[model samples]
Target: MPVTDCYTCDREAEFDQLPPRERIGHDSLWRVSHATGSELLGWLVLVPRRHVMEVADLTDEEAAALGRWQVRLARVFAQELGTPKTYIIELGEAPGFHLHFHVVPRPVDLDPELRGPKIFGYLGRPEPAESPARDALATRLGAALDRLNE
Candidate 1:
């Protein structure tokens, strides 16, 4: 995907302009932000600042930092949200999405029916009464990630 046409790239432009609920954490290579249309709280996304359709296209610095970002973000989610595990998925198939990783918190006892890829059903779905508010979740996670990065 071309940088100009990438949705992630457009969001990156909002680094300073977007509200906290939209922009989360980021470094030199990757920008971590809240996922749109997701009903799940702490649904963080890690996207490269530049457009790159494949993980193989990541530069050495970007690839190396990507690992650290994943580990750190996963750890923060586990620490702050008390998630037993985190699911990290990278699929660049969607139009304008480019290559991005979805870092999702998985409760220890996630329903069997919703395990694995099925968990994605929660994304873009209507809000559940049990779902936490996204703005509050983003604030907590963003602060936790900032402290972790320190």
Candidate 2:
């Protein structure tokens, strides 16, 4: 697919201008957090700061750092959220030219049918939730990131 304007850049811009949320944390090139309470499943999004579309666009330093950050965040989520495994996904199909990774936590007892590549099969579309819920989740995630710093 053709690359589009970077959504990560837009989000970073908005996040930087707005007051800091209690749920997010600074992890070098990206922000880390569990998904809002809407899905209590411990979903996380690792967004890059720059407006790059592919991994190839990342500098050697960024490439090396990305792996370390992913592993570290996954470890924290597993310990704090009781997740058995984490799924790191990079689907550049979206309009955002920036590269972001999805660090989805999975429980060991989770249904096999909904496991792996088919986790979101039933939830065909993103549900519309209240803004407060999102804000709350962001706050919680930000706090979690803070803990990781210590």
Give the number of the best model, judged by TM-score: 1
Runs of candidate 2 with Cα error greater than 4 angstroms are 1-4, 17-23, 33-41, 94-96, 122-131
lDDT per prediction? 0.79, 0.64
Tens-digit per-residue lDDT, 1-150, candidate 1: 435766777777767886666667777788887787677767778888887788888999999999999999889878887888899997678764578899989877778888789889888796552324666677787888889857
In the range 1-150, model 2's lDDT, one tens digit per residue, is 323465456566666564333125664566664443324345666766666778888889778878877887777667666788888888778654467777777877778988987765524345454556556655665666567778
Clashing pairs in 2: 23-139, 23-141, 23-142, 23-143, 24-142
Worst 10 residues of 1 by lDDT: 127-136
Q: How close is candidate 2 to the true structure, as a TM-score?
A: 0.73
- Model 2: per-residue Cα lDDT at residue 127: 40
Model 1: pairs clashing at backbone N, Cα or C within 3 Å: none
